[model samples]
Target chain A: MPALRLALHFIHRELRNRYLGSFSGGLWALFQPLIQLAVYSFVFVYVFKAKVPGANAPGYIPFLVMGLWPWNAFAEGLARATTAIQDNAALIGKVALPREVLVFSAVAANFLLQGIGFCAIVIAMRVFGVPVDLFALPLALLGFVQLFVLALGFAFLFAAVQVFVRDLSSALPQLLMLWMFSSPVFFARDALPERYRGWLDWNPFTYYTEFFRAALLGAGSFSLSSTLMALGVAVIVFTLGYAIFRRLNPYFEDFL
Target chain B: MQSPVLVEARRLGKTYPKVFHRRDRLRALYRLLTGGPGIDSTSVLRDVDLEVRAGQSLGLIGENGAGKSTLLKLIVGVLTPSSGEVHVHGRVGALLELGAGFHPEYTGRDNIALSAALYGLNADEARAKLPEIIDFADIGAYIDEPVKHYSSGMVVRLGFAIVAALRPDLLITDEVLAVGDESFQKKCVRWMEDYLDGGGTLILVSHSMYHVQKLCRQACWIKQGAVAASGDVFEVTQAYLAYQERKSAAQPVRQDSPSHAQEFYLIDLALNGDTADVPLVIDQGCRVGARVHVHSRDGREPVISFGVARADGTSVYGVSTEMEKQRPLRVSENVYTVEIEFPELALLPGSYLLRAHALDTEGVRLFNTLVRSITIRGESREFGLIRLKHSWPAANSETNVAP
Candidate 1:
């Protein structure tokens, strides 16, 4: 219970503190998702003239938001979490406490932004003339899974790897760029030729984006089996990431 | 019951592995063919034990690279020990390096939040106490600006202010308190006194004996990765100074044999009126005597050159062959006395060297050179040349002294 409280405590503090110097204040958290939704909707609907997966998909606006917003939560959360321990090197090396709080704080901030993005999605669906249905509620539970797991896994890997290899900082942005492209945001995964499908199965990010778009849009076009495969990848990768992070956490004080 | 040890260490030690990058590290193909770097071992502290209770404050003193900082880091839990263990019970707050971990882009208020969290305070708790910390720091308008604009002294003041306000269960302060001017240093001392009065555990590391002596009752002297001495503040300090004196004099003392040409001999030096150990002080009116040991091939009159010289190569006083009459004496390896009298010696207080030489009556020089130094410690603004002991002129005044 105290851990839950501390997590809330950390989340509130990080957002408010970051907002202190920002011009748009905490609104930037909401604004970022709104802006990305507009850009992706224009590109998919007007520029390319491609139809979204589901026919009653609440139009392209709701479809673009659901897939991209939660995906941002995962990517942004991991980027921040990877650097969490590195940024708090002072606190970790100096004082005695549960050092895990710093990493947990990063995840908490990501969760807060994810919530803001979720609120904006529901509002967008209302304006687009999409009718509410009971099945839409279940999609949230299913849709948001990739956000949490990807964040949890990537955060652990980046934090652990940062201490051993300082060059990770410069290399990470480029690595994220490549990872972002490999996901099916630029093109539909179903259009993949036979040879590329196997490699796409191996790519961890394909699971996060494809499954999320399927759940939120009710796109029966996305195979439920592929979604399960992605979910499986998230679980296995997350466990290994956390194990490596815990094993290396002890000796952090020595090098740092 | 006696106050239990709040901080205890039994053979607490920290060693670091020195990584040796492969010579072929630049060659990617070689590294791919082979592996990574090799490791070498180095120890910062070895087999150390210490105890500090709630009411006790321990002072750590050592020459540079003597493991003082390393021990402090271990006790404060900043660095874990490579072997053994340390048990610290209480909230430990360390002012390890002032202005460390301060974010330059952040304002003073934002940094205060971060600093508080770093010291184990929560956000709401830190915010509740923020006003007092700001007031204590007292850097008025600049407190609202980015910390990058703050001067080094201002940064230290803010760092000290936060620690002073919290008054944690245990405080481990490094030599950073000396970063301020004399007045600021006094303010820090007062804050330390109040903290100590609250029965807080304090571990202080300082090179200044004066500051250490004023603040701490127990002292530990570290030398070459080991505790040289540990006990009462004065005794341990004295032992450390004495050990330093011996270590400095460890240079090989040159052996001189009696010469044939001129009747000359070199003799050991004495400070004050004592002939045993060298006294550590020198001032006006303090007497110095030299007992010379000489041997001559042919019996001849001994002419001596003696002088007290300052550190800068200026001769203060000389009772030499040019000034005084030569005395006929039996010349042998046995001892002879040459005492130069000073009614009142007036000189600035600092370390000075003593020189003595012996020559034959034919005006031929023989042997020269003396001990390394004689240090003088006295009150400030003393008038000099010779120390005159005189009475103030009143009704019974005989004389008024002039330098």
Candidate 2:
């Protein structure tokens, strides 16, 4: 119970820390991603004239919005949480509380902020006559939660490893970039060459983007088998990451 | 009967891995993940057995790097022990190092809330205690400023205030009193005294023996990462002080070596019939006898002198044969011997040095000197170098009537 309270406190602090010194404050959380969305929409919709490969496909901006919000939550959460332990070296060295709370709060804070932005954009798109499935928004949130589980898994793994190998945090951005390109964040799985289409199953993040697009924009269909597979992958990754973190937890102070 | 034990450690020890290179950390991680044998490490603390019951105060005293802080950290659960285990059953408030867990970028007020949460206080409980903490810190508007902007003393004041407000079952502090200004230190000491009086337990680490003696009823002296002595506060502190004194006295003793060319040279000095250079240990108030053999180059009688000093070289008493109008007895052509005895030495329990000096026949030119260390061992808590003779009469007696 105390651990839960401590995690809540850290989450509160993490949320405040992002906006503490910035002029935009909480608005920056929404504005930064919207700007990124605009840049992507300008490049993909206007320059390349990209379109979803279906007769009744959603507009490129709506499709991209659906995929980008969840992607941002996952990527940002993983990035922030990966360095959580390393960032709080001062606290960890002096205070004795559950170390996992730092990682948990970092990931939770990002997902929370991005989750709010995701809702705002979806509601705005619906009002603008984009035909967003507002009723499916609840199901889409479930998809976001699954993605969070996966991100937290990776966060725990990377955070623990970052303590021993500090290069992980420095090298994380490039790795995430490569991962973004590999996943179906910018394009649908159908856009890939027919021969490579089936390989999307291999990228754990592919299921999240496709699931979000299907749930929010009603553009794609998700099968029961794929849902089970994604859930299995999230659980297995979470278990593995948590196990490694627990194994290395006792020795963190030595390395720090 | 004693109160319940709030802390117990059985052979608790800690060792830090030797990570000179970055690669070593990775290798250590790999080994730890694989459940392999331990890596190369340096032990900072070893075989420490300690127990503190409720309301008991313990003072930890040692030189720097003696692992006193490490021991406290282990007990406070900040550091994991490499061997054995330590259990602390009650809430602990620790103020270790400067600015202990405070974040530099956060305001002091925010940090206090965070600290309150870390101590397992709910939001309402924390809010209830907020005013008390702020008032005790007494830094005024600086509470809203970033902790990084505050002075070191201000940081300590705030840290101590937070800990004081919590009033945890066990309080562990490491050299926190040394940083604050005089008034703040007095405030902290007063607070600690009141806390102790209210049955709070404490484990304090300090370099100042005075503070240790004042606040702690039991003391543990750590030397080279191990307990050198432990027991009553007075006895342990006295032993530690004596050890320090012997260390300082060990240096600059070359002049004590006898050289025959001098007009007068002291050949030997003995304390309590023990002539060896090793320190003589005696109970407090026991008789102390000093015998000296002086060698005179001229066939003339020499004046002998005996002096007593605290181990740190503070002079306590000195007397010469010239003052007593006595002369040393010549036993040979050029050798003379003199002896003095104190039937009841008034010196208190601690370490002291006894010196025997040889002067010329005129008692003017001091030629040679020899010294020996003597330790008075007892359970006396009286202050200063000697135990004064006095009597406490009954209040009803005529001696109690004032003029």
**Quick one: best DockQ, which candidate?**
2
For the predicted complex of model 1, DockQ is 0.23
lDDT of each: 0.68, 0.90
Give the per-residue lDDT of model 1 (tens digit) for B1-403.
8997888889987776544453321232222224444234578788888989888988999999888888877887767777888899887777777675677777888778776766666767788888888887888988889899998888888888888777788888889878877777888888888788878778899977667767888999988888888988866765665555555457533435444444555555444445443434555346555545444445445566667776456778767654666453454534444555544556555445566666655656656445545555553333343445566565543354443
How far residue B82's Cα lies from its native spot in candidate 1, in Å, is 1.4
Candidate 1 residue B106 C-alpha distance from true site, Å: 2.6
* Residue-wise C-alpha lDDT for candidate 2, range B17-53, written one tens digit per residue: 9999988988898899898888999999999999999
Please tell me which predicted candidate would have the highest TM-score against the true structure: 2
Scored by lDDT, model 1 comes in at 0.68
Predicted candidate 1 versus true structure: per-residue lDDT over A162-252, tens digit per residue: 7655667778778877877787655556557878867776677766556555555555346778667767777877888787777667556
Clashing pairs in 1: B285-B345, B294-B332, B344-B387, B345-B387, B346-B386, B346-B387
Cα shift from native, residue A61, model 1 (Å)? 4.5
Stretches > 4 Å off in candidate 1: A1-29, A33-48, A53-61, A90-93, A96-98, A130-146, A186-189, A193-211, A221-239, B20-39, B122-128, B250-403
Give the Å error, residue B389, model 2: 6.7
